[model samples]
Structures are given as C-alpha cells and as structure tokens.
Target chain A: MEKLTIIKVGGKIVEEADTLNQLLDNFSALPGYKLLVHGGGRSATKLAAQLGIESQMVNGRRITDAETLKVVTMVYGGLVNKNIVAGLQAKGVNAIGLTGADLNVIRSVKRPVKDVDYGFVGDVEAVNGEMLASLIHQNIVPVMAPLTHDGKGNMLNTNADTIAGETAKALAKLFDVTLVYCFEKKGVLRDADDDDSVIPVITPELFRQYVVEGVIQGGMIPKLENSFSAVEAGVSRVIITLASAINQDAGTVIKK
Target chain B: MEKLTIIKVGGKIVEEADTLNQLLDNFSALPGYKLLVHGGGRSATKLAAQLGIESQMVNGRRITDAETLKVVTMVYGGLVNKNIVAGLQAKGVNAIGLTGADLNVIRSVKRPVKDVDYGFVGDVEAVNGEMLASLIHQNIVPVMAPLTHDGKGNMLNTNADTIAGETAKALAKLFDVTLVYCFEKKGVLRDADDDDSVIPVITPELFRQYVVEGVIQGGMIPKLENSFSAVEAGVSRVIITLASAINQDAGTVIKK
Candidate 1:
C-alpha cells in the first residue's frame, strides 16, 4: 500500500460532533491517510465530575491517581477512542482503535505523583513499530490512546502528544506519511487572539523563540515539541492547525 | 469454560504506588477472572484544565466535546488501563488492555445533546459477549475501558457502571463468577458520609426507598441501577463495595 498521513487530533478539536464529523470527513476522505492518534482530556474530566470525582494534575500533566486512572481508562480507552473509530468507520474508513497497552504496542514506566505514587502515568519509553506497522499494513487506521504497559503489564496514563510524536516517528520510518496536529485554535499565532496571525511555518529556532516569548506555552508547548520530535524523526512534515482549518492548508508546519 | 468475573477497580483505591501495588497483588492472585474494567476521571479532569479545556457535563453525564475527548482517549484508555494490565502481568496474570471498542465488543449510539450532538458520548446499546468470552476463555483477563462504538461507527462516551452492568449481564449468561463494583466509598451507604453504615444487602424495594430518599441519587444511582440490572439479569451475585474489600466479602449485595 502507498504511504498514508498520520493526523493527531487534539481532544479539543473533536469536542463538538459537527466539528469532529467535519474533520473526520475531510481527513478520512483524503487521498492517502492511515492513522489517527487522539487525546481525550475534556471528555474524561467531564465524566469524572459526573461521578463526583476530582482530578489531580502535576505540572500540567495528569497525576493519574487511582480514581483518575479509572476515569481515564473508561473515558479514553473505551468512550473517546471507540467514538473516533466509529466516526471514521461511519465515513467508510476502516479504522481500528488501539491502546498503547494493547498487544504491547507501546511500553512505558509508571511514574510517581508528588511524593505519593500515581497509579499509571507513562513516559512512552518505547514503541513496537513492528506491531504498529502490522496493524497499519492490514489497512487499519490505528486510532491509538496514550495508555501504555509498564513492561510489567500495568496500564499507565501518558501524554497524547508524546505518544503521537513517537508513533509518528516510528511510522515515518515505515511509511511516507504527513503528521498533523489538529486543535481548536487556528494554529500557532504570534498573538493569542489573532486568528489570521498564524505563523505559516516554523523552524527550530523560531519555535524556540516562541516558547521563550511565552507565545507557545502550556498546551501549545507540548504540541510544538511533539511536532518537532516527529519532524526530527523523519516524518515528511508536521502541521498544527485548528480542526476547522483541516480542509485548508492553513497551520504552522514545523520543519526540521 | 467457566464464566468470567468482570472486576472494576475505583481510581481512588490505587492513587499511590502502595495502593496500586497492593491492588496488583490482589488482582493477579485472582483465580482466572475474565475481564477488568477501570476508571480515571480524577486525573484526566485535572489535566484537562491545565490544557485550557473546560470540562462540560449534561445531566451529570460527561458531554464529550472535541477537546475533552482527546484527553480522555489518551489518559484513560492508554495510561490507566495499561497500568492495571501491567500490574497484573508483573504477578503473572496475562492481561490484555483494551477499550470496549477494540473488537466492537461494545456498541452504542450518539446521544443527542439538546439541539446539538454530544461529540462522542455514547449510550451503550450492545455488548459482544461472544468476543469477550473468547478472550476470557483463553485465560486472558480483558482489561476494558468503558467505551463503546455507535452502530454507525462513531465512538461514544459510555458510563463505566453501564459497561460493568452490561458486561456482567453478558458474563452472567455464561459464568459463575461475581460482578464487583469497587469504588472509593466503602460501600453503598445508608448515609453517604458514614462509610461504615454499609448497606450489606439491598432489594428492589430497598433500592426504591433509597431513590425516594435521595440516598441513592446521582453517582450511586447508576451504580445501584447497574447492580440491579445485573441481579435482574441472573448474575449469580452483584456486589457494590470499596476497593479495599477486594478480598473480603463485606459489601452491599443487590438481589433481584
């Protein structure tokens, strides 16, 4: 099979049904595409609250306390991941949802939370490209979740950006695919409020400058870092743009 | 083959490493259970806020908007689910982490959100018991996420209790094991604040009274409903208890 595009749709972009459908319609129908790695923070949090659970985070990362891990497993692996798979399937795309812990596709270590031990937070220690590629080669878009096994056989929560970055890198070695990070915002902007001010392209140096200037801090920081990592790992190109701008070539492309 | 036991562990119980290690110790020692279901709301919500994604809910149900779903897919399914699997494996339990959507084992429909559609929220409509049983029969405990696929091929947010209920019911038709709902609270309390006042037993009549008195309202409502559903479906027994009661037999038991 010809190489396909690997798109990472941030949880924010797929929050709305219409928006998700629109993005799915555009991407699933694209001439060549193979995988989608999604994040599920928003949905997980909402569901957690409904269950009267309070989430814990450390330095912008989910602490993955026991209760939080429960919600994460339920929401991300079960709810959000399947929905995306179903979305692609509804669009006539043969999508297969894969979690990092499934079949040892992705492995990691369980990190600690504060002084206490968090249940299952992973660092994406490694990726099994052979297994991942086999799935992709079977013509299934691997809709992956950022959960991994600790080699010891426990599920751990991980950064979606990190998972997507690593997966993109691994897949890039096996296929000629474009990796795009789709978010709610148009793209990397010089000014937070200006939509049209998206930096059409970013280099390693400019990307660093944006980070230092705080223009690309917080969530955008990991996104840019992941994009850069993918680009560095030989992904043909990586674009970060709003889900709405999915149809248009309007986003920041991080090039090595 | 004997029917499988679908074990659900609360997030709070495994917040720290000790708790998680203890959890793994017990989980691995189980006598060939069939499946495991987990939740991680606490961690994902905290992470969602840091990402600037406001968690949204409707009627106490998580409104899976695009951004929220991303966090969910990554954290719960990927991180936490895998952690549990890894924990089990460390003790020689051959477990496979998965979301219900992995094998289309669970299916649902896109619940309409007022005039809008909840992006990925799913009301589970079916459980692929045969598929789940196949895995269980192979001596593999399927660690599942509370996610389901809309018959239309979109992944939808499903309640973990709902997943547990349906899964228990499915297994009940085939297994001799118990369906356990482990949560942070010791047991279904007559008084929510008094954990020791565990309702050791419940009948449909008692359940109705609790509902009228609001003791079984909100989160407990679903848990109770699931328990009731499982009991009614002929599950040998359905227990609602604290995660600490994994080995002990003290908990609320719902009878048909």
Candidate 2:
C-alpha cells in the first residue's frame, strides 16, 4: 500500500490570512497522496455574528441550528475550503474542494436529541472511501470542509476532527494512512503552559493516566479519543501537533 | 457520441427556496448526461449587504472588488453550489459541485482593464473537458458555480453563461452537446411585453432582422451572441428558456 497522510487543520490555522498562507505553504510542501480536512468555526461564528445570528454552544461544541448551518456551509465549504484549494493549485497541486454532500462522499445522520437537539449537526455515518481513493489515484487532492449531509436534501454541520478520523480509517485499507490533527499547540503538552513539554507518544495506558491526572481534559479529550479510534481502525498512526510543524513530525503520536 | 445537456440558470431561479426546489426536480428529470452551471448574483449581493460591503456595478455588470469577491466566493461557491449538490443527491443525480479551480477544471485569465477595471472578474481561457467528462462518465453530474481562478492563487468571479458556453464547447468533441440558458422568461421574446411570444427557432438571419427591428437589444444581445458562439463551436444545439420548463422543450432553440 502507498503512503497517504490525512491532515486535519483547525479554524485558527486556516481562518487568518497570514496563518493560512503559512499553512498552505507547509501543507503543499509535505505531501504525497495527501488529503486535507479543515475547520472554519471561527470564521463561521464571525460571519454569523455579522449576519446577526447568535451562535449557541453546549459545553465547547457548537449547536448547529438552522441558521448556523447555513453560516458554516458558507464559511467552511465555500470560503475556507476554496481558499485552501486555490492556494494549493497555485503551488501546482491539483486540489478539489468538497463538502460531504458533493459526490455523496460522506453521509451523516443528524445528531438525535438526547439532552440537546443539536439542530443541524450530523454525526458521521459513513465515508465513501472508494470514491475518495479514486480521486487521490487521479492525483486530485480533496480539501474537505466540516460539513456533511443527511442524504435527504439537508446539509449538516459536522466536526472536522471526526471527518478526518473517519476518512483516514476508511482509506486505511488501501493506503498506509497517517492521520494528523493540527491545532494551536505543538503537541499534547505535559504542562499546558509550556509548549516545550510535548509528549512524544501516548498509548491507551498513558491516555487513561493523563485523563485521571487532569492533564488530558476538555477539547483535547475528544481529539485524543478520535486519534486512538483511527489507529485502532487500521490507520498507521495519528499525530497531534501544530499546523505549522506538520512535516517536522514533532507531535504526539497515538499508538494502540 | 453520448448526448450531454449543459444548463445555465441565473440567480433569480436558484436564490429562492421554492424556485430552487422546483429547479432540482425538473433538472433531475432531464434525460441523459447533464451538467449545471449556476449564478448566485442576488445571493452574493444580499450577503455583501449583510457583511457591510457595497456591490459595485457598471453597465449592469458587477465590479468584483476584493470584498465583493469574498462575498461571491461564500455565496456562489459555498451556499448555492452545495444546496444544489445536496438537492440533486436527494433526487438521485449523484451530483458533485465544482468551481473552475477544482481539478483545474477551468482556467481563466483576469480581464484586462478595457474601460473600467472589473476587479477580480475572469475571462474563461480553457476548460478541462476530459477531466469533466470523466466525472460525467462515472455518472456524476457536476454543479458548477460561477467562479474561476487565475493560476496565481486567486479565485475570480466569472459569468455563469460563459462557463456553460465554454464548457459546452470543450465537451462538444466528445459528446453531442446541447447548451441550455435558463432565465426568468420563457425564451427569447419576440415581443418584450409578451412572454408567449417566444421565438422557437432563432437563425442568424432572423437574429439580424430582430436586431434591426429593435426587438432584441441590451442584455439579450450578449446572451444570444453566447448561444450562437456555442452552436458554432460544434455544440449540437443551444436552448434559451425558463428553468421550470427545461424538460418541456418550450423555448428558443438556436441553430445555424
């Protein structure tokens, strides 16, 4: 199997002009048969504020109401995804921007109301790995937006981390997939305030110990869970690091 | 040769909910291989207004300044394009939404300053017919947004009609192509006030006679010019009609 690296970037890395340029520069450089899955949460929130729509959040996750879904669709699928694609194309990468709705790449179920009705939020159901792998085989790099569909004519807001994990797992059968989750931090830091205290690796044993120790809490928890899940599903490795240092391999590597 | 119908619908039909749903229904029913190129000018303008950016137009053509370009990217590439893709998916069309930049499907040069600087507008230079036809061959319908890219990392606002015409021309060699231009009216009206006065078949001689008769003037001239150009480029036919009536064949058909 050939090597395929799936990079999942956050809103901070892609939303600003300077960071985005740097991200594009770094991303275009480190690659062979790579795909990008991106978040546009900050941009979506900003656009929603501009459009006078209030963004609701439960815990730290956004509640994707009807209007919020439209905002995210515009920001993530349209603005951010296309910018990355054009930038990659300028660098001679044949990049295609996509939402899960396009080509039915991913079909997701709208999150059912358990305690909170996350209106238009979708929990991913399936990823069309063959269709996606075909594009990679054609040398067309897909830049995915954090959006999915219910397959019944509705767009749903989905998590970029989950999108990346699901896609990586799906494509793992045909490729030596390395899933990279990029955030603002360098890696999973031993000391949250100290960037240099990067934990080089984390296993299931370490994950539990850290969770109990209050070092692995909040948003980092779900991210780590996704990383672990991907590795278990035949993905070669899962890296957590800063978007700027993707090629450097200076990040937390998750092992089963 | 495989027959392919390329339909171009303006913002009026696609920007509204009811009209868009109707369009997806009728469009899905069109026989054989097909592609859709759409405009989102109204939606873009509305978004621009919401974002506190003013849309500038000279001679009824939008001047896509930096801010306006962002608006169009969000509206045309994101919101309208994805909506169409999702709707078609529900209708079993297996649609994939694309912009010119995607897969390098269309490449355009920025329009040089002739009289006024049309900021980021693109003049269609080439279309990758082989790449696009491959998508269609795989039974995926392409929903194209009215946007292109300069090879230099910039997304340029393009005319939907030109995209359709150019794509139709490019694909003509591999497919028997019929280019359809859908606007608000039924067709090229013989009488401006009478929607029933649609000229069923418009030959060059009749077009010249109508121009002299002052029946066809202003915007309709360029649209007809585009229709004629597509026909001459080996497209089997060009249909000018309403979006709702695409399957009914109740429109002006352009011929040599």
Candidate 3:
C-alpha cells in the first residue's frame, strides 16, 4: 500500500501570516501523498465578535449556534482554507480546498441535545475513503476545512482532530496512513512549561502510565485517546508535534 | 468532443433559500459534464454592513478594497459556494467547491490603478483548462466562487461573469462548451417592460442593429458583447435566460 500523511493543524499555526507561510513551506516539502485538516477557531471567534454575535462556550468548547456556524463556515472554509491552498500553490503544490460536504466525503450527525445543546455541531458519522483515495490517486492534495454536513444539506461545525483521525482510519484500507497533530507545542512534554521535555515515543501501556503519573492530563488525554483509537483502527502511525517540526523527525510517536 | 455546460448564476437567486434549492435541483438534473460559477454581491454587501465596513461602489461596480475583499471571500467562497456544493451532494452529485487559488485553476494579475485603484480586484490572466478537464473527466462537478489569486498568495475579487466566460473559452479545447448566463430575466427582451418579449435567437449582426435602434441598450449591450466574444472564442453556444429556464430550451441563444 502507498503511504499517505494526514496532518491536523491547530488554529494558531494557521491564524497568523508568518507562521502559516512557514508551516506551508514545510508541508509542501513533505514527500508522498498528503492531506491537510485545519482548525480556525481563533479567526472564527474574532469574526463573530466583529459581527456582534456572542460566542457561547461550555467547558472550553464552542457552542455552535446558527450564527456561529455561519462565522465558522466563512473563516474555516473560506479565509483560512483558501489561504493555505494558495500558499501551497505558490510553493508548486497542487492543493484543493474542501469542506466535508463538497464530495459528501464526510457525513455527520448533529449533536443531540443532552444536558447542553451544542446547536449545529456535528459528530462525524461517515468518511468516504473511496472518494478520498480517488483524489489522492490523482495526485490532488485535499486541504479540508473542519466542517461536515448531515447528508440532508445542513453544514455543521466539527473538530479537526476527530476529522484527521477518522479520515486516517477510513483510508487505512487503501494506504499506510500516518496521522499527525500539529500545534504550538513541540510534543507531549513531561513538564508542560518546558519546550524540550518531549517524550520520544509512547505505546498504549506507556500512555496509561503517563496518565496515571499526571504527566498527560487535561486536553492531551482525549487527544492521545483519539490517536490510539486510530492506531487500533489500522492507521500505521500517529505523531504529535509543532507545525514547524512536520519535516523533522522530532515529535512524539504513538504506537500500538 | 464531450459536451460541457457552464452556468453563471446571479446573486439574487442564490440569496433566497427557495430559489437556491430550486436552482440546485435544476443544476443537478442537467446531463453530462457541468460547472457552476456564482456571484454573492448581495451577501457580501449584507455582511459588510453587519461588520460596519463601508462598501465602496463606483458607478454600480464594487471597488474591492482590502476590507471588502475579505467580506466577499467569506460570503462568496464560504457561504454561497459551500451551500451549493452541499445541496448538489444531497442530490447525489459529487460537487467540489473552489476558488481560483485551489489547484491554481485560475491565475490573475492585480488590476493596475488607472482611474480607480480598485484595491484588490484582479484581471484574470489564465485559466487551467487542462486541470479542469481532468476533474470533469473524473465525473466531479466543480462549483467555482468569484475569487481569483495573484500567483503570489493574494486572493482578489473577480467578476463571476468573467470567470464563467474565461473558463468556458479555456475549456473549448477539450469540450463543446455551452455557457449559460442565468439571471432574473427570461432572455434578451425586445422590450424591457414585457416579460413575454423574449428574443429567440441573436446574431452578431442583429445585436449591433438592435443597439443602433436602441432595442438593446445599457447593461444588456455589454452582456451581449461578452456573449458574442464567447461564441467567437469557440464556445458552441451562449444562452441568456432565467435560472428556472436552464433545463428548458426557451431562451435567447447567441450564434456566430
């Protein structure tokens, strides 16, 4: 099977001009088949504030109301996604921007109201690996926005990490997929404040040990869980690192 | 040569939910290879007003400053384009939404300041018909937004009609292309006041004669001029009709 790299980038790397360009340079230089999944929460929040729409948050996660959904669609799908595509094109990479709804590549269900109503947020129900593989086979790199649709024509806000993991899992049948989560941090650290305290490799047992040791707490816990899930689902590897370290072999590797 | 239809829809039809759904239904039902180019001037204007940004217009044409360009990028590329893609997907058409920057499908140079600065507006330099043909051959329907990129990583506001016309002319080498300009009017009318005054067929000679007799005046003249140019550029036919008249044969056809 051909090897494919799937990178999920956080909003900070993509929100600014300088970092985005640097990130794109590394991304464009990456060898082999690649797909990019990106988040634009910062930009969306700024735009929403400018438009006088109040953004509601519960437990540090945005409640995607109808208006907030519009803002995210514009920022994540339009501004941020197109800029990345254009930047990659300037570097001689043929990149195509997409939302999950574009080819029905990802269909998600609206998050049902339990104790909290998340408005138009979606939990992905399916990812069309066949369509994605066809695009990859044609040498077209897809830059996907963190948005999905409920097959009935409603677009929903989705998590970028989940998108990358699910997409990697789906494409595992056709390719040896490597899912990378890129953010501001160097990698999972022993000391959260120290940049060089990067753990080289982590297995399922070690991940549990770290959790019990309080080294990997808070948001990183769920992130690792998702990564392990991908590995269990047949994805070959998963990496967590800074955006600039994409080409460098300097990140925490997740192994089954 | 295989036949391809390129439709350019007006902003009004897309702004309203009912008309947009109807338009998407008609568009999805069209046979063979097809592409959609759409305008979102109305949405852009509305968004600008919301963001407290002044929309500058010189003689009814938008003067796209930096701020206005951002609004259009969001509205046209994000809101309008994504909705069309999702709608087509729901109807079982594999549609991919794009701006000119995506895959570098279209490259434009910034319009030099002559009389008006027109801040970030672009005059299209080239369209990559080969790339477009490849996608169409793969049975993927492209839904293009009215935004172009200046090869150096800048997104410029472009006219949707020009995008449609230029794309059709470029694709003429690979396909027998039909360019349709769909608006509120049925066709080129003998009298602007009467909805029933549809002109069946128009030739270059008749177009000039009608202009001399004041039968075709104002905005319609330039529109007809563009239609003639497309015909001259090897487009098999150019149709001017209402959005609902897309599938029907009832519209004015421009012939060489």
Best by DockQ: 2
lDDT (Cα atoms) of all candidates against the true structure: 0.73, 0.92, 0.92
lDDT tens per residue, model 2, B20-123? 99999999999999999999999898889888998888877799999888889999999999999999999998999999999888999999999899999999
- Native contacts recovered, in order, as a fraction for each? 0.49, 0.84, 0.72
After TM-score superposition, the amount by which residue B36's alpha carbon in candidate 3 deviates from its true location, in angstroms, is: 0.9
CAPRI-style quality class for the chain A–B interface of candidate 1: incorrect
| Candidate 1, A1-256: lDDT as tens digits | 3576777777776656777788788877667556778788888778777667887766667767777876777666766676677777667676666666665678787774467565668877778887678656656567887667677655678888788788878777788767777866677888888878889898899988888888778777766776777788888788888766666778888897
What ranges in model 1 sit over 4 Å off? A1-84, A91-96, A105-150, A153-256, B114-119, B151-153, B190-194, B205-222
Best-fitting candidate, scored by TM-score: 3
Instruction: For residues B1-256, write the lDDT of model 1, one tens digit per residue.
Output: 4645667875555445787788777776666565778776765676677667888776656777766776666556655666666677667676666665665677777776677566777877778787677667756678776666665754556777778788888777767758888876777888877879899888999999889988788777866776777888878778777666677878888886
lDDT of 2 by residue, A1-256 (tens): 9999999998988888999899888989986899999998898888999899998888667998878888998999898988888888999999999899999999999998998888899999999999999999998899999999989999999988889999999999999999998867889999999989999999999999999999889878887887888999999999988888998968899988
Off by over 4 Å in 2: A212-215
TM-score of each: 0.57, 0.97, 0.98
DockQ of each: 0.22, 0.87, 0.81
TM-score of chain B, per candidate?
A: 0.88, 0.97, 0.98
Q: A-chain TM-score per prediction?
A: 0.89, 0.96, 0.98
